[model samples]
Structures are given as C-alpha cells and as structure tokens.
Target: MMKKPGSWRQIVWLLIFTLLWGTTPAVGGLFSSLSTEKERELGEEFFLELNNNYPICTDPFVSSYINRLGHKLEAQLPPHPFKYRFYVLDDPSMNAFAVPGGYVFMNSGFIRLMDKEGELAGVLAHEISHIYARHMARMLDESKPVSIATLVGSLAAVLLGGPAAAALLVGSQAAGQAAMLKYSRDHEQEADDLGFKWLQKAGYDPRDMILAFKKLNKQRWYAGGQPPIYLSTHPHTDTRLVELANRLNMHADVLPKDHDNQEFQYFALKVDSLSGSPYQLLRRMTQAAIHEPNNPAYLYGKALALAKMDHPDEAMGALEQGLKLDPGNYFIRREMAIQYFERNRYQQALSLFQRLAQTQPHDETVLYYLGRIYQEQRQFADALSAMERVQSLNPAFVEVYQNLGTLYGEEGQLGLAHYYLGLHSLTSRALPTALFHFRKALVNLPLNDPHYARVKDQIARLEKMKVKVN
Candidate 1:
C-alpha cells in the first residue's frame, strides 16, 4: 500500500533539482511555467523517473491507444488555460497523478486493470478533474516555500562548494517532506464526485466509478499480500462504491445511458492488435478482423498491425477501409498522412493536413507537419509562413523554432538563425543543438548583435545548468 511519501526520498529529489538549477530563481521560474515546453520537459523527466523508480510492462499499441483515449477526453473538456497531455508510465503499480497544469499520468498497471472503456474513461476523467481544479497548483502553493528553498539551497551549495555541501543541503530538507502529501479526505471525495460528473458529461456511465471500485475491492482480496497503490490513494473503496451507486440511482433519468460492451471490446482490440511482437500482432489482428470485419476500429488495428509487420501495402488497404468507415476521425487521417509522408507522397500528405488544419487552426501539430511537408518540397517561403503561424500560436513549440533556425541558416540569415536556434533551447531537448548554432553564429555575431548576443547568453546560462536524474 502507498503511504505518505518518504521524507528522505523527497529531500533527495529536492536537493537534486536544487543542484541541477544552481539556485537561480530566474531559472527556477523558467522551468515552473505551465506552457507546453515546460510540460514536455517535465513530462519527459517525470516519465523517465517513474520508469526507473517503478515496475512497468511496455507495449506500444497499448501506449498509443491510451493516448488516443486521452486526446478524445481532452477535446471534450471545458476550456482551461493549461494544455492537457496524457502519458502512460511503464509501471505495474495501479496509481495515477496529475502534475502542475494538465499533465495526467497513469501507470501501465492502471491500463491493465481497465476491462472496459468506461473504467478507463472514469480514471481519466478523475485525473482530469484534479487538473481542472488546479489541485497540483494548490499543492505547490501549500508546499512551495520548503520545496523551493530546499531546491535552491541544495543547488547553491553544490555550485559554490561541490558535492559535500549539496549532500548536506539535501539531507536538511528530509525532515518535513511528508507535509506535502497531506491532502484531506474531503479533497479526495470532491475530486471523486466531480470526476463522476465529468465522465457522465463525456458520455460515459456514471456508475462506472462504482464498478471500478468494485474491481479494485475484488483485486484487494484476490491479491492478498499486496493490494495496489490505487487502493491507497483512493481510500474507503466500499464507501465510494455506495456513494456512486446512490448518485447513479438518484440521477438515473439524467445520466448518460450505459456504454456499449462491443464498443469497449473494439477499443481494447485496437491496443491488443498492435502492441506486441509485430508478427504476433499481425496474426492476432488479422484473425480478429476476420471475425469482426465490419468494425472500423478492428480494421484500423489491423492496419497498425500490418504497419508494424512492415507490410505497408496491406496496411494502406486496411487504413483505407477504416477511413471509409470513419471519415471524421482525425487520428486515422493523421496516420494515413504519416504513411504517405514516409513514402515521399508529400502532395497527398499536404492535402490531408491542409483540410485538417482548416478545421483545427490552433493545432500546432498539424501546422508543424504542414511546414515539414513544405520544407521537403523546397518551398522555403511557404515553409516559413506555416512555421511562423505556428510560432505565433504556440511559441513554446521548440521544433518550430528549430525548423525556422535551419531555414534561416540555409538561407544565410545568420542573425535570424542564431535567434531562432537560441529560442529552440527552451524545448526539452537541452542538447548541443543550441550551442552548436551559438558557436557558429558567434563568428558573425557582433558584440551588439541583436539576436545573436541575447540568444548566446541564454544558451550559455542553460549550458551551465545541470539536470539530476532520479
């Protein structure tokens, strides 16, 4: 069972971040934003941490399927300031958490526990409620002084006096770390109630919350020695089950109808069909399709299985059938575009993305890919235009910055190239790319160079910062 977080472990994490950031408040602020760039950096870091710290079973098809579900849920969510992104942690522990902003994380164990779509949707909606309600931000606000001080002090000590001071700084914060996780039982109940509502509004059965709890309760007895962590975070399962049942009964007339069992099965098949060894996946997918030829998701799964098996022609045909059945599915269109792009059919990919972007103007991904297609066609001007629009829409998208940098460098706009490359450092890939361009630009960068000098300093500072891996 999951208890309160360990004081010593929390201290170690705080000190690690402190040493990494060198106690610079400015740098701390830089990493603290709710933007996509910050989220990606934090997401990748947290993803790596959870994997290293926990047990997980990896399956690509399952991962993609969960993400697809998350995307659909996100689209249905009411507007919020933060960008919600979901990640499946490769951990067997049945636990989930929402970080600052809209990062909803789930372990593979949670995925394995999901027997029906509503159960999965219930979990997702629960996590999303935490995010929408700013639970993480509240946690941070309540815990920040200690957390940030420990973080800064550790880093400052490390930078000034090296490893010994860093160790001491970290050890100091180990005393009060448990205070961070003291969320009241009321907070848990509130999140649960709102989560149930969210699921209902999203066309899921409100009763799934109780069903999910029932599943966990059964697992607790069946697994004897070690009940899942999910049991720990979500306390009083029986009480919650009763509460959900009562609510469903009271609101029966207003509630969404029960979900389709066949639909849930189709959803599960989408993951199972593409998740294992390519040959195994292909065999399962083909057999499944033969048994359920009319299911669009099954056809799509077979396409994914074919793709994994390296049978592109077969995959293309399968994808066509799937698309014919579900024309409005952006995921299908996006995958089809990817296939065409891989085959050097730029025009076809461009056409599809263009239509998608027209309806989804704020979709930076579509815009980014559109820019890529233009660039591949040597339409630098058009490429620049598309990328520029994306930059305006989401400046934190470092890939767009990187693309712009490359275009500028190729076109001999050294000043522009340096600036763009420098901004690209804001992305999660804190690598040599930024420094490489900085060095190249230094030759042409005047002491008073507008873009080069400013960008160079940011790059230099970031280069000095270190990252601590958990």
Candidate 2:
C-alpha cells in the first residue's frame, strides 16, 4: 500500500529538512510593515531555502507543461507588481499554496488529483487570486506582532502534525490564532470568488472549480484519516460549495469547451510515472497500454518506469513500440534520445537532440543534453558553446554551471572554473560555499579583468544573504 499522507516518517523527514535549511523570518503576517520590495526579496529568500531543502521536480516536460498552463491563466489577470513564477514540489500531498509574492507551488500529489485541465486551472486561479488580492498582506495588517522564531516553529509543528507544538505556539496567542483563522477563511472565500471569475475569463469552465474542491474534500476524509493540510489552511465548507454551485448556475449558459485530451493524458501519465513506485507504475501503464493499444502515452510511461527500474532493454523496447505508434511524438523522441545517450550512443542522441533543438531553441534540457554529449565526445569547443547557450537561456539550470566549471578547469582556466563553480553552489543554495568560491575566483583574477566587478558583486550579495538566513 502507498504510505499515508502525513505519516510520522514523512513528518520527521519534513522537520529535519526544514531545520537544515534554517528559517526565514515570516514576512506577510502580522508584519504588515514590509514594503513591496522587501516582500519580493523575502519571497526570493524563501524560494532559495525551498530549492535547497525540498525535492523540486526538474523533469523538463513537467516543468514546461505547468509553466505554460500557469502563464495562460496569468495572461487573463490584470497587471500586478510582482513577476509570477510557478513550481512543482515533489510532495505527495494534495496541497497548493501561494507565498507573499507571486511565488506559487503545486504539489505533484495535487496535480495527480486533478481530472482535467480546467481543474488544474481552477487551482492555479485560486492561488493566483491569493497573490493578486494581497491576502497575506492584509492578514498581517490585522494580526498582532509574532516573532520569526515562533512562526517558524509553528510551521514546523504543523508539518509534523504535533499537537504539542501547536499548543506551545498558540497558547499565548490564542485570540490572535482565532482571528487569523477567521481571516484565513475570509481569504479562501475571496480567492474562490476571484478565481472563478479568472477561470471563466481564461476560457476554462467555472464548474471545474467545484470539481477541484470536491476532490480535495474527499481526499481530506482519508488523508491519513485526518484533515489534509490544504483543508487545514483553505477550510472547505458546505457554504463554500454552495457558493461555487450558485456561481456555476448563474453562468450555466456558458457551455464548457473542449481541451486537448491527448496532451492532458500524456501530462497526467508522466506525473503518475514520476510519483508512484516503478513496479506499480509499470503495472498500471501496462494495463493502460493494453486497454488503449494505440495510445503512445501509456507506452512512453511504461518505458519511463522500466528505465527507473533499471531494465534498459525493456525500456528501449517500450520506447520503440511507442515510436512505432506515434513516430512524430516529441516526448517519445526525446525519451529515445535520453535512452540512447545513457547507452553511449552519442551520435544518435546528438542527431535527435539537434533536430529537436531546431524547434525548441530555448529549451535548456535539450541544450544541456547537447552539451553533455559534446563533453563526453571530447569536443571541448562544441561543449562550451552548447553549455553557454544553456546559461544564457536559463541561469537557474544548475547542472550547466557544474559542467562549465568542469570544462573550464579541464582547460586550465582556474579563475573561470572557480567562478562557474561558485555559481553552481549559489544555485544549489550553499551560500557560504558559494562565497568561498567567488572569493577564490576574485583572488586569482586580474585586477583589471572585466569579470572582477561581477565576481565581487556576487560575493557581496551572498554574504548579505548568508547573514539574513543565519
């Protein structure tokens, strides 16, 4: 059986993970004094901490799909001050949350829970509403001052499901906690109202919001046989459901439009393959493939599960079958290239990636693969070029930083090697280590070097952030 959500082992893991990453001073709550700039900075800091501590799903297909969906919803919203970002957290809990700024995260579990694209849209729309309406800021405005340590401790306790932790944190601030809960309920209602409007405006069915809520409500009943964290925070009630139903009735004339079901199926299967155990996922995909013999997605997912289980030959066979079914499928071709690269078929992998690159010029994953193939082939110049393109396209691609550092070190460019290594460390959220590398790069670099100022600035910024985090 799958491990229950909020299991003790999971809680312990989360507690340890949060502690290791340290804590950021909670920003938007009773701390209404924070300015817009400060809120953005705090959000960035929290993002870094999460990147360091949490298992962020970096699968290229998954990331690209969510971002595309999120941006579509974002386009329908009015202008906002903060730049929005969407991320998938590798957690198997049906939950989603928005930070003080425009940082939104959806758990892989939640993504799997969604039955349709519009259901996913409804979740994103609701979270986006939270950010746009400045709900956190207003909540902070209404509450009394709470220390950062106390707030983090409370959060940790919540994650661990420790009643003692809750009692310890809330005993003195019982009235404040009550008020905050009430305000949070209000925030949920407002988000639902605004989210319904945005989803409809974005050309998605408003009825899907009710679907999403019902799914969560059902999950809450069996979520470790306790209330889910989402319900604890969002608080689903009959009143909320009635409100959603009434809105849908009012907009009953707006007929729901069709979406690309094939694309949705592929994305959903990918999520399932990534989240479930390899053997279980393989069995499920095999059954799916048997039922839908012509569907390439099930074959592709089976191939992925096979690969995860270290059955490369079986994986390749599944991929070949998938390719035969849908020769022009991008995902199948991409998986074939990856499998080829793993088996050291560099030329074949290179040809496939290069072909894909023509259409996806800005895809960092493709560029990274191209760079890796070149590096393995000992084509130093080509490797440098490919990795540089990746850097320019997405600075957050941490693998490129390590590869560049290795490439420069091989060429005996110590300063550039240390510089890129510093960047890799920075992206990995090892601030002190990053600062050390940046300082070393600066020491080796010439005073008149063009890169000198940039290295110095990085070192200074890391130092400041280190102080704040510690």
The TM-scores, one per candidate, come to 0.63, 0.80
Candidate models: Cα lDDT each:
0.60, 0.71
Candidate 1 residue 452 C-alpha distance from true site, Å: 14
Candidate no. 2 TM-score? 0.80
lDDT of 2 by residue, 335-426 (tens): 78888998899999999999998978877668778999999988887888888887665443345688898888877778888899988787
Candidate that would win on TM-score: 2
- Alpha-carbon shift of residue 285 in model 1 (angstroms): 2.4
Runs of candidate 1 with Cα error greater than 4 angstroms are 1-93, 107-121, 132-184, 199-204, 209-225, 257-280, 320-334, 347-368, 384-401, 404-420, 429-470
What ranges in model 2 sit over 4 Å off?
A: 1-32, 144-183, 362-364, 378-420, 438-470
Give lDDT tens digits, candidate 1, residues 1-470: 11122343454554465444434322444333244444434444443333333322233224344555666666666777666656554444566666544666666555556678888888888778766766544544454354333433432232222223336454466234333433346666777788887787778887777776677678777678565666654567677677778878888888777776654554454444333355665676678778877667666667777876778888889888888888876656766876787678999999998998888776666777788898998888878878887766653233467889877777777877767775564442334555665666776667776665566665565456542212
Give candidate 1's whole-model lDDT. Answer: 0.60
Error of 2 at 62 (Å): 2.0
Residue 28 alpha-carbon offset, candidate 2, angstroms: 16
